[model samples]
Target: MAVKPNQTTILLILRIFQSLFAVLVLALSSFVAHWYNTTTVVSSPSQINFLIFIAIFSILSVTSLVILPRVFSNRAVANPYILLGIEIKNVLFWFAGWVALAVFLSRLLFCRGSVCHAAQADVAFAAMAWICWAGSAGIAAVGVFKGVKKSSGNNVEVPSGGVKPEAVEKEAV
Candidate 1:
């Protein structure tokens, strides 16, 4: 029998894929930085700047996807408002990823033929990362609008301080 996927399962899968893409970008950027720096004495200043942005974006994207899913999935303490807030944050992070990836790609494109070889691998990886970030951000925005469900099993009851509602009603009569 095929198990049906739920919200938690879907969120986990997306987060995993996002993290994987982030890792790929991280690795490819690092390789580009190391290779281009050691092989050539004169390096494009923008190349290092692009590498730094990619590295920072990769780390933050991975961290947010890994941790925020857990926070959003825990039905035990799941507050719809809080989940909405967290999802908003996730959307912002992924949007930042989009900006960083765009800058990195533009920098790679404007470089010369020789530099393009090293950046080719980064281009492919960054494209994947860009797609992943876009999807993740869109999903988060949807979540914020859809709202999270509260647990059905637990209900709370309040005890009167000294008198019950019925008693208070009688006293006012």
Candidate 2:
């Protein structure tokens, strides 16, 4: 199947949204964690570390999903191998980003008794980021699924004689 320009445009838009959400998640989570840790007398080293890890992961995933596509798609030559590699990368980043968001959500929910006391702004930002990231990841996954299916659908098999057995039977009858 021929790839339409609209499909590419849609994918780019979704990726841009995903990258924006990822940036929000990183910044808000970091700021909240830092603020909570500094204010509270009881320090939680693990929580801070986890936030840092999430931020780093989001940065990497966003970079992969946002930057690599433009690089791969803009090549002078239409290399099938390069396209396939990019599809694989998209799948990985989308899945990873989704999982990271889930982890962040879980951490927020499971904190004990103001252990990770985030500011009102931080909480709001994190919630918004979660919603946006979920949408972005879902779109990316759909793109990956359709891409793989389309590639497979293109490789239809034909009979050796290029004629159906049903045709031969009908002729005989």
Best by lDDT: 1
The C-alpha TM-scores of every prediction are 0.55, 0.46
Residue 130 deviation, candidate 2, in Å? 2.7
Model 1's alpha-carbon lDDT is 0.54
Question: What do the candidate models score in CA lDDT, each in turn?
Answer: 0.54, 0.50
Residues 34-135, candidate 2: write the lDDT tens digits: 656788686544434454455466556556655554455434332334434544554454445445544564666555444344433334444554555555
Tens digits of per-residue lDDT for model 1, 1-173: 99988655665676676667656655666665676678879663454446446646556655655554445444434443454454455445445544564566576536655445546655555556556555655665565555444433343221211123344476799
Error of 2 at 60 (Å): 1.4
RMSD of every candidate to native, in Å, equals 11.4, 12.6
The candidate maximizing TM-score is 1
